[model samples]
Target: MKYIWIYAVIPVVYSIMFFSVRGGFLKSAHMLNIRFLSGLSIDDGSVRTALLVIFAANIAAAVITVTGHLGSTAEDGYLLREDYNGQTYTQNLELSISGEERPIEIEVAPRSYSETEKEAILSRAAMKIESIILEGQSAGHINQDLKLISSYEEMPIVISWVTDRPDILDWDGKICRGIPEEGTDVVLTASLEWGELEKEVTIPLTIFPKELTGDEALREKVNEAVSSSNNSEDEKLILPDKIDGKNVVWHSAGSGQGLIVLFAGLLFAALFMFSRIQNRDIQEAKRQEALLYDYPHLVNKLVLLLNAGMSMRAAFEKTAHDYRISLKNGGPKREGFDEIL
Candidate 1:
């Protein structure tokens, strides 16, 4: 029973000291929430109730923060499928031109082939290459406009052609730019050199005069406007009335300082709580020692009274009575005697 009381009393006393210290600090700076924090300082059942509520709230908040952090990390692609699997995989992740653009699909498969079969596969791949379109031109008219088609691939392609009419359609190393006087079929051979392997493709081209329609002209204008808008310095500013005006600019205000301050406050609170809880056993032991120091004197008085021939109940009652009188008259009170009484 005494051990149980000590266990209960230590926490009760710790709670009082914790709340009083916190309340005094907060009160000094006029930041204390009286309605909430003040209840813990009061010597009543409400203090225990408040502690229970605070503990439950902190646990709930911690759970929510952890869950949210995990969810956001997964959504942002920080978590990968390969993390949980033992198989290796590769992905070509690229940003889309527009949000609605579909991702490019690549397939990987294993096959055993002879050298002849591999050469046949390369030959088939090279024959599949069709006519190459210049950067700004549409696919319909290749002959009317002599546009220089530059190499857009990461590795430059070597172009060589044997045309029936070399004078009409000519090829420079960089670009194919020549106006054909009449409509004629021309064969163009382009080769890509990668390391020691060379892949060649033949392209059939027919050039004719192209007439621009009203809709096509309007489309070209719109394309030009979009391109100019993208390249403009004021692209971030938005002005709906002006077609070339920019969208609104957004600047990020980072939370580094705020996070640092918040973490520091949490660290301080944790340290304070740990310090108070850690010293609880020491404080309880000290209190017990003080009470035990008075035990010898208390036992001696009880022995004297017992030797005086008084009854056991009378002697016990008289001992308690004397302690009460002393306490009431401002005399020193011994904790050991008080417990016995």
Candidate 2:
């Protein structure tokens, strides 16, 4: 009931406000220029379109609100369950208990797998560990870090990793410092277990030093220096003045170079746009001058026709008809007389 009232009142109030802004009634649909409604009067088309939109929005809100609250009446400790299959089932649910203003969220899953099925799932997952341990690099020619996972998600299995050469490759698959220039060999062992079943998988990897460009190597040295300075207990923070063999220069975070570049770009764009606007205005002025070039002659002709006993309407038609004939015969266009026609 609360949800229904909240959703229902919102649409009703919105409809009232929308109509109130347009004279407090659904008499016209103003400011809505839909293409399909071009044939109908603007007011009539807008009124009908507004009513249809409001009706659809209110109906959708009501339906969604009502359906969402249908499961609100579920009791504590009650959860819907799926039929048993080979795979595990889990669902996240939010429960509202009596006298509690906030809902309690919990996860529910059905554990109906047999011992035989569990062992088979774990065995397959353990086999996949060796293929993925290299993390896309070839095992015989590895130069990057490995992706040693603590667990496999396909089955209920916990994995623990151990490396024989811990100095070259840590248990977490990170390549530690001091990798030799000629490369070395390392072995990674993964212990996989599910319930009482346990299996071990070993992967042999040849690790070479991670190749770094000049800039990357310099960046690493600077980062190391900055990290080393972080633990100093000196009164003022000391920054590194040199990295490797190159002299280092420290600049404040608020550098003006970026702002200067941005201002220059904006200035160029503004000048270009201003020039375009000036050209447009100049062209419009010339067009207006051309439109009024023969204005005095037209007025004189109109006055003479009037003095010669022709009606004002007849004089205008005659002038318009003559202009049309002239136009068809490749005469220069006069927009002022075209508007009169």
Candidate 3:
């Protein structure tokens, strides 16, 4: 009987009761000035149908969310359901984070908060802070120099911006009002995060600003300032720009000994190299003239050896030895006799 009530009786009876209801349940109850105990209202046939659909949908969603939260499903596989919330469209109801080995299934529903929820959220925030400290070490907000100041009434939240934005502090924080101590230069820690999400969060430091100064010292110093230009009558000279853009004082002098010495050194080096090259050229010409005379004699000897039916090697050797003897007799020398042969 319980199983029948659970499965068959509940569904059938619930549907029948819904169809047999007289007018709209909400309207009828409101007219009688009676309150209905149900969380959902079956105000009209269409509304009843919508509620039934919503109930089935919420049940399916709750089941899906609970299953995902339990991590009892394949990675490639996922369930789908209508959001039905007019504000939000039918997008994938999954929360994807980078470097996450598992795709996290968040319990997607209407965002609501309670005291218990707020506590849980606070605990989560604490965990996040701990994680940041663990990963960041001293590089995080452990050593930052920041100051915040505001009134005592509102416990002002301060947010520092290291971004390219014009302001040093972004719009995330507000100045608290009516502070007991006049706040000025309150010290706070700054943090910067980078990756899939760019999050810049500051860890609240144990420091606050010093009590505000009423600017009396500055006012007194300004009052005592000597504001007279009494030394303005001193003589001055106007200098002219030189042709080479140098402030060269006018003088009746030509080039100095330093310039002369430099010119002489340059001329001596150039003349010395040129003279050596000219001497080398004269020696080369004389050598070429001597070789020209020796060429004809050497050719005659070779012609005689060829007529005498001698081998080319023997002819060349005989000519080279004869040329050496002629050189010993103070005759003009032939070059590369051994090399040419």
For model 1, how many clashes? Answer: 5
Q: lDDT tens string, model 1, 1-341?
A: 11233444445544553465445533422343445554434544455466656655655665675565555433374434332114454444433566664555333232334556546554554553443433444333453444334332322333333445455456641223234446556665656443344676655666554444788555555565556556467647332323335444345789699999999999999999999988997888877997789888887888899999988888888899999999999998687887867
Residue-level lDDT of model 3, residues 206-277, one tens digit each, is: 212222345843333333332221233656433333322334464556759889999999999999999999
The segments of candidate 3 whose C-alpha lies over 4 angstroms from its true place after superposition are 1-256, 335-341
Q: Assess candidate 2 and give its lDDT.
A: 0.74
Highest lDDT, which number? 2
- lDDT (CA) per prediction: 0.55, 0.74, 0.47
Q: How far is candidate 3 from the true structure (C-alpha RMSD, Å)?
A: 29.3
lDDT of 1 at 257: 98
Cα error, candidate 1, residue 336 (Å): 0.6
TM-score of 3: 0.23
Error of 1 at 198 (Å): 62
Instruction: Report lDDT (Cα) of residue 117, candidate 2.
Output: 82
Better structure of 1 and 3 per TM-score? 1
RMSD of each predicted structure? 33.5, 20.6, 29.3
Candidate 2 has its poorest 10 consecutive residues by lDDT at: 24-33
> Per-residue lDDT tens digits of candidate 2, residues 71-146?
5444344665444444344444454558556545554455466888878777888788878776678888777777
> How well does candidate 1 score on lDDT at residue 152?
24
